[model samples]
Target: MRMNFGHLRGVHVRVFVPSSPYFPAYAQGQGPPPMVQERFQSVISQLFQYRIIRCGGAVDDDMANIIVAQLLYLDAVDPNKDIVMYVNSPGGSVTAGMAIFDTMRHIRPDVSTVCVGLAASMGAFLLSAGTKGKRYSLPNSRIMIHQPLGGAQGGQTDIDIQANEMLHHKANLNGYLSYHTGQSLEKINQDTDRDFFMSAKEAKEYGLIDGVIMNPLKALQPLAAAAEGKDQGSV
Candidate 1:
């Protein structure tokens, strides 16, 4: 659940962590969409249980810098303990994502990601940034990919020029995804031409994630009924 903070005067856009049990301010983040607030929140809860620190959302710096700082701090505090990152982001600048992604790849800590809602654009790239033993969303959750699009205001010639830039951008994005996913560069380029969104099941099949995690709370009632049936059979 979220509210319109637009009414506030002279407001500075800051990412906020929603209070636990009811993540209200979560969807109102700086780096990504707020829809998967619940899923990201769940990952945070899980990480805290293991004593990993949470960080980020520092004003105009794209937030990745803040995230990196936090991870480094955690490593210093406890060199032996592994860290988990719960990322729910639509992605920001390429430079920012690359920095954060590199931090995850090179950091000595154990970094795992749970793509709760949607990891679109550079956000999906960050998911691919996880070191190893990564997890993903339930089958219904979305994962998307594509090149960054710049806003344009120009004529046909300018449009053609932008198209060329788009092609180059696609090449760069494919280079990274192909290197990580091991898919053909041609396939990655083709897929990013248009927005490609995959369900968790599809992501697993493509080797994007280790597996899909069904919402256990949503399945509780059915499991309870199955348990009751077994008990009645014994009776």
Candidate 2:
């Protein structure tokens, strides 16, 4: 599905993963031990079983692709299921985050985003873009939003172009914040002008998350039920 970033220039992003039709050496007994491979497979299986995707490192094209694929795969397998995304990153590549942020809103299955560590900049954007009431953060998680950064080389013309791009990008980001957090443009602009940081509770107060997660099982119950309800309806 196409994404809408409103007034921001559209940039095509691609996610690349090296793959082959034939089995790898690992599967052919030339790599890790079978036991190790089994453990690796088991861990991967658990991710799909729980329908959870982790975005722990800096956000980039690869992470964005993986997330979109996971979300799409989950929806295809069971459209009514919930996809839990745990984010812990300093955030990177605004374009990359925008891809995931837009996909989170476009997907059919409900998405619950949990901040396990730090969700700064683009990470903060993704956290707030979660399925509204399903947005969450751990007790100790930190959330932040700030203006975009840029540096230009070449000549003055190149520098001017980069500066203009940052301005438009900031405006688009502000609009995104207003749409998701129910905050006005003025307030979002004021807060994001600096390196704004907040604790989980403070984030909730700022309308970034619905609540701070205290008990995982209890906190996820409603989301689970909602997914099941969708499943039953589809069936």
- Candidate lDDT scores, in order, read 0.57, 0.73
Question: What TM-score would every model get versus the actual structure?
Answer: 0.62, 0.77
Q: What RMSD does model 2 have?
A: 8.8
lDDT of 2: 0.73
Candidate 1 on 1-235: residue-level lDDT in tens?
Answer: 1111011124677746443222345342354465575688787666555644332221113366667776777777776555655445555466566667777766676665556566667767766656544434445667777766564458988777766765665577679888767778888878877778787777666656655555445222212222233221110
lDDT of 2 by residue, 42-72 (tens): 7766766788777766677777887888788
TM-score for model 1? Answer: 0.62
Best by lDDT: 2
Model 2, C-alpha of 79: deviation from truth (Å) = 1.7
Total residue pair clashes for candidate 2: 0
Cα deviation of 161 in candidate 1 (Å)? Answer: 11
